[model samples]
Target: MPSSVEPARPAGHHTPGPPGPAPATPPSGDGSRVIPFGRRTTRTGRGRRTPQPPQPERVVAPDSPQQRLALDVEAWFLAHQATLTDEAAAHVYRTTLDFLQLMLTSSHAEERLSPDEYQHLTGMMQVLRDAPDTL
Candidate 1:
């Protein structure tokens, strides 16, 4: 049998020939580089699932007080509903803004009020509404 090893070539001509398969990667334009080995693998079966584009995030309207307030109320209602029954949360959400003027005047209306304070006032209203039956 022939020897397993081939005699070594002289320097500068020692590069081995191709191992008999076409390269998996497309050739680069310059041909000056071959992609490093093991960077890709061939799949034998069905192709990979292409990733889906992400759904766009829900964006709050900028610089609009009404939109911001509506979104805040919606978010608050969702959170409140998690702790309380749906009917109670709905009642609070509907009636909370009904007393906005009263809350503003009571909370020192000379200065600006925050959305959170308004939400707090609504929560107080919810408590007050339930207090009568509890007594």
Candidate 2:
């Protein structure tokens, strides 16, 4: 078998690479950006399920106060991910936001969120809402 390691390159050598995707936000002093990787992986299945007409639909008006609040909460967490308790909480918050999206678009929000998880989500949102600068 060949060696497992690659031969070292000269110090002055530079390899061209594709420009990476734009950062969601400006990098901080550490040159790191926060990414919301939870938006997609939170939901998994054979495929998306359509709502059954027989089930009652929960309507959340796009401009309604609750919807507005949810939007604000999401934006805040996305911008302030570094301040969150941990990466898992940030992921869970994204999952919670996705659940809210399901509530608005389908009759199936309860399937992904448990009572305790929702309670924690709401508690975090409530803290943000209670902040002096929250809208």
Clashes per model (N, Cα, C within 3 A)? 0, 0
lDDT of 2 by residue, 1-135 (tens): 224387855765644433777657666764433233444565676688978779655666668666666566666766975423355655665566567654633432534666666566666555543322222
The Cα local distance difference test for each model comes to 0.53, 0.54
> Which 10 residues in a row give candidate 2 its minimum summed lDDT?
126-135
Q: Who wins the lDDT comparison?
A: 2
Q: Among all windows of ten consecutive residues in candidate 1, which has the lowest summed lDDT?
A: 126-135
Candidate 1 regions with alpha-carbon error over 4 angstroms: 1-42, 45-47, 71-135
Residue 23 displacement in candidate 2 (angstroms): 79
Candidate whose TM-score is highest? 1
Candidate 1 — number of clashing residue pairs?
A: 0
In order, what is each prediction's RMSD in angstroms? 15.9, 27.6
